[model samples]
Target: MVDRRVHEGEAVIERAVVDGRPVDADARLALDARYGHFTALQVRARRVRGLDLHVERLQSANRELFGAELPRPEVLGAIRAVLGDDLRDASVRVYVVAGDRPRVLATAAPPTEAPTGPWSVTPVVYQRYLAHVKQAYGFQQAHIGRQVARAGFDEALLTTEDGLISEGSITNLGAFDGERLLWPDAPMLHGITMRLMERMDVPQERRPLRAADLPRLGQVFLCNSWGLMPVGRVDDVPLRQDGKLMTRLHEHYDAVSWDPLD
Candidate 1:
């Protein structure tokens, strides 16, 4: 693996290992100029949920961006290098660096923990350049999130010019209408957790959602790799905070099968 071990016990926090070589991240990435596409997922026992989907995501993005093939075998070797031998659990991300010959970069850290949320968010008229690809578009999201924070909000709810709801800066938006789970059908990154939830035993739908519908919804929550969380506030409007529902959602997610890397 890449010699990222640091601290007293020499704990390894593997990240930015490019094509079997340890690279200076600053030089290789060139501040997003060389960055291509990526997929972030929590790996348990060297495996992950929706592993196939994650691979498909990378391959699709590669084809779209570079018209090249990102073989899973090549990616697997890079990821295995990052994980080493016996890692129980970690948060991992595989990135493709665009160039004459695309390179693979694998990043790993202690599994990402859930953020304490009942988040306060504000709606902003913004859309990602390539919303579908999990790429280096964090700069725009961070910018909007900071502006929302200045207004006493924890997150930014992205919307269209005409007030059609899309998604959060970093999470998928879901609404519980006292019966069914409603997901916004607007242009946004279709997250793995959201896709998994759709396959699970939950009353859900994908439909066009407007910003005005938040008030009409019984409860609103955010879903992502971290977990499900209640949306306590949408701008000045306070939505229902159902801890029980959140717990039930987590239970459902926990029941989903974990895919082994081997």
Candidate 2:
């Protein structure tokens, strides 16, 4: 078992270990904000969905950003060490920073409740750098999210310069056209959850989705590592929260097998 302790008055408490040793709060934050690539996922009862995909994402990002290979076994061991046996349901993040000596940081905390949404989103004209890699881009994402929230929207939909809807600040956008799912044909991170949905034989298409196409789409959903959620409106246009589609997505997602943290 790993050490577990709580700081008072903290709703979400995270315990972080660097390499093999536990780190102080400042050290944890420094590593997290440094130039690194990371992946966040859910852990339930010490098991995770799409474990291999998460590992692959970390390795791919490490190789792309740092020109270094992250050994699969070591990454898994770090996650296992951080999670230890205390996992009820939690959120875990694995961070890899490049330097003369590379550092790996793993942190785990109680999972936040999934957003209950029929969310309203506003499109922002922006694109992420190295959009395929999940790097430390939290500041920009948070800024956009805050701006949308102030405008009475739940989240921000990122669009390219050509007015094509690409993705959400932290979520991947999916459209269901009554017959099939459509993913935006743009540079965006292929989320592990999205990949799992595809593996379950969810009929999907990748194409350019313009802002004008929003009204014609049958339904829209936001997805990330946590789960699938419905979207009710985009900008000023209201969308259908297709109950049948949500049910099918949840069923497919729940059917995925969970792998042990080890």
Top candidate (lDDT): 2
In candidate 1, list every pair of residues with a backbone clash: none
In terms of TM-score, the best-performing candidate is 2
lDDT of 2 by residue, 1-262 (tens): 1011111112354678888578888887677557888888888887889999999999998888888889998888888878766665778888897555678888887775456768787889989988888876367876777677778877778998888888888889988777688999999989998888886565679999976787788788888876887888888888877788788778988999999865
lDDT of 1 at 241: 72
Question: On residues 1-262, what C-alpha lDDT tens digit does candidate 1 reach at each position?
Answer: 1111210112344455778665565754562467688877788887788888888988999999889998988877777777777666887778888666887877777776556667777789999888888765366776776677667876778999988888988789998776688999889998888887777576788888776678777778887776676788777888877777677777888888888877
lDDT of 2: 0.78
Separate clash counts for every candidate: 0, 0
Model 2 spans > 4 angstroms off: 1-11
lDDT (CA) per prediction = 0.75, 0.78
